[model samples]
Target: MKILVPVKRVVDYNVKIRVKADGSGVETANVKMSMNPFDEIAVEEAVRLKEAGKATEIIAVSVGPAQAQETLRTALAMGADRAILVQTDAETQPLAVAKVLKALVEKEGPTLVVLGKQAIDDDCNQTGQMLAALLGWGQGTFASKIVAGEGSIAVTREIDGGLETVDLKLPAIVTADLRLNEPRYASLPNIMKAKKKPLETVTPDSLGVDVASRLTTLKVVEPAKRKAGVKVADVAALVDKLKSEARVI
Candidate 1:
């Protein structure tokens, strides 16, 4: 069985984000970049599956600029057998990404596809579901635990009220959640080895996927600054302020 895992490169979670001077988008120039935290979890899960003899080959894939190859290398260092980089300089939307992954799925014929629940940069939380829909396959999103069986996979998911268990047939899509196993750091030796791992680069057009953006960004602005709280003289003053100044009453 082959497992396909998609990873993404995003600004470091620890870095403080800044809005562009022009209302365009967030600043990303020369900023610290790393694999999406959730994607790291997905990679770790694929690695675990391979270690358990459930998966024969693990392929790490990334869709972004040329730099995204770095993210795929990180996955290889984590234990993926090989990697693929979908080279595109455009800002890819969820639908476009899903289409690209669908194309790869058709070509690779992996029995399982794993992905992060969401990318921190967009926080859209839509790609996995979209991919599953596009492929007409079973989907297990926000999976906390996964077990491979004879011909199906059982997934324990994190839901609103509590955990929910669902069994999906082979060739399904699973999205990793925070409760999934913690990712292991790539060792120095593995990092060196990853450099030699097979990494193929392909354009989205070559895959016959149109990546045109359907949505337009009107403006990107920083959130309004919160106002400081004022101390009230007494209960009566607080009530008066609430009724008059704040208009809560």
Candidate 2:
């Protein structure tokens, strides 16, 4: 089985985000960037599957600006056989990314596709489902556990009340959740080897997918600062304050 994993590049989670001065978007200029955390879990899972002898090859893919090659290299260092970067400077929304992955799926003919549940930068959480729908394939999303069988994979996913398990046939999609697995750091040797791994770059136009943004951002602004809390002397004072100031009573 050939497992394909899609990764994303985003602002490092540790960095404090700053709104652009013009209310355009978050300031990414000279900001530290890294692979999406959830996608790292997805890549680790695929590599484990290959190590377990259930998968023959693993491919890591990313859709973003040319800088995203670094993100794909991170995946290759994690044990992916190769990497593919769908180069695009435009904003890659959920729908456009799904279309690009769909085109790659057709060309690569992988048996299974795995991706993160969401990218931290956008937090849109729509790409995996959109890709599954476009391909008309079975989907098991937010998967915490995955077991591959003869021609299907059983996925245990987290739900509102509890966990739910579903069996998806081959040529299906699975989105990795937080508890799926802990990601492993790339070793120095592997990191050096990743530099030599085949990293193919293609344009959205080459994939025949029009990546024009359908949604427009009216404005982007920083959230309002939270107000400081006030202390009350006793329960009676708290109740009075709630009634008069908060109006909860």
Q: Choose the strongest candidate by lDDT.
A: 2
Compose the digit string of candidate 1's lDDT tens values, residues 85-123.
999988988999999999999999998999999999999
Compose the digit string of candidate 2's lDDT tens values, residues 7-106.
Answer: 9999998999999999999999999999999999999999999999999999999999999999999999999999999999999899999999999999
Residue 228 deviation, candidate 2, in Å? Answer: 1.5
What's the true lDDT of residue 85 in model 1? 95
What does candidate 2 score on TM? 0.97
Cα displacement (angstroms), candidate 2, residue 200, comes to 0.4
At residue 241, candidate 1 shows an lDDT of 95
Worst 10 residues of 2 by lDDT: 227-236
